[model samples]
Every structure is written in C-alpha cells, then in structure tokens.
Target: MLGTLAAVPVGERPELLAEPVAKAVAGLPGILVAEIDPELADTAAFCEAYASPPEFSANCVVVSGKREGQVRFAACLVLATTRADVNGVVKRRLDVRKASFAPMDLAVELTGMEYGGITPLGLPADWPLLVAPEVAAAEAVVIGSGIRGSKLAVPGALLAGLPGAEVVENLAR
Candidate 1:
C-alpha cells in the first residue's frame, strides 16, 4: 500500500498519465494514480519520499535483444525487491541469444513515456509483457504512470490481465 501520497481513481487523473498509458487504462477497474515529485521517479527515491514499501513497488524494465538480424523488445515487470532474469528466462522467452535492458532513449521513444516512468501498460501490441509471479499475485503494487510526475497503484491481478501480459514463474530473482 502507498503512504502519504493521495491517490485518486486513475480515470479521474488523465493529466497525470502519458497519452498511451492514459488510453490503455481509460476504463480499467481498481486503478489509482498519485502525483509525485518528478525528481523522485526512481523506485528507491519514490518509495523513500512517499513512505511506500519497496516490496510493494513494481519496476517495469524494457528489454531488447537481436536474433537473426532482427531486433525484439519486451517489457519485464518485477518487484522492486527483485531483479528480472533478463539473460535467463527472458532471453529464452524471446528466443534471443542475449537480453539486456534497453537503452533509455529507445525505451522512452518507443513507449512514448518519460525516461524513468515506463510502465507495462500501453507497450506496443507486439511487445511481450513478461510479469513475475510475485508481482502478479501481490494484493497491490505501485508502478510508473508513464510520466515522471505520477505513479499508478493497482491490484496485481490487474497487471497480470493487461493486454499482452504473460505471468511467468521465476521471471525474477
């Protein structure tokens, strides 16, 4: 659960979300959005400043790899307390020889989100959204809102059900 920061139904704060993220969560249920200092968008800083627990915050990382001269991209969602198994599970899932966090510039450009606020919502339809089981089963979790100035809080089940999302066991460590 989030502390101190006031959270409102996401639908009521479209301005707090990036365009694509706004559209993606437009009619979703049980989603809350809160405004935060852009400077504290990073998970550790945001949690510390907002009095939120690190375990209840989810990090969305953009991963990419090349295979046979083609590039593939995916979004991996893991709890702030864990790290995604990018080179192991993710590389095998994407059928790539290696997987790594995508460059910040490319991630921002492709997701149409700020550098530190790329959430799993509104990723390109073709991009696989791999979610760790821990994140998908949490009662609630805080995640980016596609903008540095805000964050979204939602039930883990909601994230697991997002379009393109695939809950994967041991996706994180």
Candidate 2:
C-alpha cells in the first residue's frame, strides 16, 4: 500500500481511470491504481490526505513555446518537491525563445484530461515527455490518472521507457 491508499493493478479497476489512461496502461506491468477524492487531486492536498510524501509524487506539467510560427509542446514529469524549470531548461530544450505552462484550457483540451489530473501516459504521441532524472530513478511514484478522482502508481523506470520519453538532468528546481 502506498500511504493509506490500497493500490491494485490498474487493470483490476479500469473504471477508476480516464478512457485514455485506461488504454495507455493496458498491458503495462508494475502499474497500480487507487481511487481518491477529486477535490484532493492537487499535489499538496493529495499528499497530505493520502500520507504520501512529495518526493514520491510526480507532477505532470504541460509546457509550450513557439518557434518561428509553430507552437511546440512537451510534458514534463518532476517530483512534487520541485517544479519544472519551464523558462530555462524547457525553453532551451524546445528551442523556443520563451516557454511557459500551457493554459489550463489548452492543456485539458489537447490532453483530453481534467485540469488538475493530466498525466504523461496518454499525452499526444507527438509531444515529448520529459522525465527528470530523480523521478526516473525512483522505485515507484504516484501520478495523476487523467482524472481527479484517481491516481496511478508505477515504477519510475516504466515512465522512462515510454515512447518519446527522455530522461533530462536538472529538469526540476
């Protein structure tokens, strides 16, 4: 059990996951799912209510920047204790003059996820998924399930291995 949450294999509770998340996790090993109060889905409240530590919770942030005229986007995974460095590392990585968190409406529409519960698992295949070294090396980490009512627990290596995923150093600060 992670904190007081009784996590079980994600496949065992498909109803708890968003449609895209349910599809993304199919056949993915070492993934667990647990239900939670929607109102506590934010990192701080979720951690406090579930007795999970910030270091063990990963936050998925969507960042976007325009180069020339085309907008480029990426999803970054960082431990809750630190925030993604959107202005520095992310900007440089995306090769854009400026980078910022994507607007909530855009993020939700593009990712097909709720505002507070976007996860990297089911993001558009074209978007790069950035995984912080610290997060990618953890034994297991908690992440959103594409909806506020549930969360997913999985080995960090699983995230690193996802398609288009890159392990970035100093991604968080």
Candidate 3:
C-alpha cells in the first residue's frame, strides 16, 4: 500500500530547486544545500528566516544600476544590520552614472532566477561579484539557490572561485 504524503506549500517544498543554481553548484566540493521552512526569496524575508543570526546579519542584497548606457548589477553582501554604501563605494568602483536597487522584475529577468531567489551563483559571467571582506572570512555562508525555500551553504572560498568575484574590504559602511 502506498503511504499518504504530506502536502507542502510552494514556499516550503524541499524538491522545488532551481536548475541554474544546481548547475552552478554541481562541481563545487563540500557544499550543503538546505531547504528553508519559510519563504526566503526576498532580502527581508531571507534575513528573518536565516537560522544563524550572524549570517542574517551579514546578508547580501543584489542591486543593479546603469552606467555609460550599460546596465550593471552587483551582489552587495553586507551585514543585515548595516546597509551597503552603494553611492560611495559601489558606484565609484563601477564608474556608473547612477546606482540603485534593481527592480524585482529586472533582477529576476536578468539573473534568470526567481524574485527573492536570486544568488551570486550562476550569475552572468560578466557581472561583477563584489563581496564584503568580512563575509569572506566566514568558513561558510548561506546563499539563495535561485529559488525560494532553498539555500546553499558554501565555503567562503567558493564564492571567490566564481569567474569575476572581487574581494572588497569595507564594501559596506
């Protein structure tokens, strides 16, 4: 006889993983993927649902801006307790005319990830990955799996392994 299975909400389904995120993490070693019980597809929700308080405190918020007629996006990982100094550091480093939080629709379209599920992994190879130096110091960090309800815990080193990640000290103030 087949046993009855409990139904799970879309935001809490364990198997609802994103393909791109899986592909990006395929060959990485020593990484653990966890499914969150609460919906963590957005920054605020993610911070609230994060189990490790410190991790939540140092969350990354992805932002997109325009410069020289080109669209640029960056993953600004900062303390959830703090805000990324976008205007002072990110804009200056990217040499952009304007820097602003990318709209949810554009962020999803450009990254090919669901809103609130966007992560640095699987991002376009050309897009810059700017990480706060302090976050890099952690042994492992939890990041979105390109879908809600799932997160990937990866070694700090793996983040730098991405094609164009640049380590930036004081990325946020």
Candidate 4:
C-alpha cells in the first residue's frame, strides 16, 4: 500500500526520487518497489524509530576525498550498527590523502538527492558505489526515496544494478 503523498501514477512519478530507481529496476529483471512511511531525514533517528534493535538500519554514506588533486566522492551503504570506515577502507581504495563525510549541502547539490534520501540509483556514473556485502545479502532493505517524505523497499540485487555499485566485504566496521 502506498502511503499518503501527492501520488503520481507509476508512469508519471517524478524522476528526481523514484524514477531513477525504477529505471534501474527495469534493467535488473525482477524487483518491485514497495513504498514505506518516510521518517525524519536523520539516520540515527530513523534507526531508533523503525529498526528492530534500534541500530540495524543501513544508511547510504557519502564520503569526499581528493585524488591527484581532483576531488571525488564515493558512497558506501552500511548498516547503522556499524560505521562506514571512510578513513580506513574508503581512503585506501580511492588512493587519496584524506576522506571525510561530504557536507550535507554539498551532498545534496551534487547528488540531486536530499540529505537523508541519497540512494545510489541516480548518482553520477563515475562515482564509485561500495556496498557492504552484508547489505547485499539481505532480502530487502529500506532506503531513502530521494525525497524526505518517502522511503523505498528494494531488493538487494537491485541496488547492485546501479551504475558503479560494487559489493565489498567489510566496508563498514
């Protein structure tokens, strides 16, 4: 059941939030987009409110780094139970001097996704998407729908179908 919002027919929904995901799903073969109640944009708060142990929610983390003097960003999706090892794995993988969480404003501007709703679906093709294997193992996961007022339940495989998503083990700690 779709939750309350100005509902747009499946074909007419805005591309900003759900459309990219829809397109990604189309290529993946067989995944359905189930809608869920939107929560406050804060990951911690969302986990506390909906997650079983209040800490099992997986958040899409955006990290920024400079490689060869050119700035780049990578997104890592990890469970709230553990933090994305941005300073460890991400920095090493990107071969950068330093890596830090992108500021919310910058994240929003670059990704065209709200602070809390940044899914990898519509991210820039060149941006690397490192997904924790644990997350990919789950049947379905709840994630932001590119808007603050909605959420989406999508299969793990669908997530991997995004342009540059790579399933990595122990991406988080």
Best by the lDDT measure: 1
Q: What lDDT would each prediction earn against the true structure?
A: 0.94, 0.93, 0.65, 0.68
What tens-digit string does per-residue lDDT give for candidate 1 at 1-173? 78789999998889999999998998889999999999999999999999999999999999999999999999999999999999999999999999999999999999999988999988899999999999999998999999999999989999999889999988999
- Give me the runs in candidate 4 sitting further than 4 Å from their true place: 1-39, 47-56
Clashing pairs in 4: none
Ranking by TM-score: 1, 2, 3, 4
Residues 1-173 of candidate 4: C-alpha lDDT, one tens digit per residue = 12232333323344435445455444443333333345555666554544434233467988999987899899998866778889889998778999999999999888877777887767777889998877777675666667665555556776765678998876889
Worst 10 residues of 2 by lDDT: 1-10
Error of 2 at 121 (Å): 0.5
Least accurate stretch of 10 residues (summed lDDT) in model 3?
A: 1-10
What's the TM-score of each model vs. the native? Answer: 0.99, 0.98, 0.80, 0.78
Clashing pairs in 1: none
TM-score of 2: 0.98
- Clashing residue pairs for model 2: none
The local lDDT score (0 to 100) that residue 68 gets in candidate 4 is 76
Q: Which ten residues in a row have the lowest lDDT in candidate 1?
A: 1-10
Q: Mind sharing the TM-score for model 1? A: 0.99
Flag the better candidate by TM-score, 2 or 3.
2
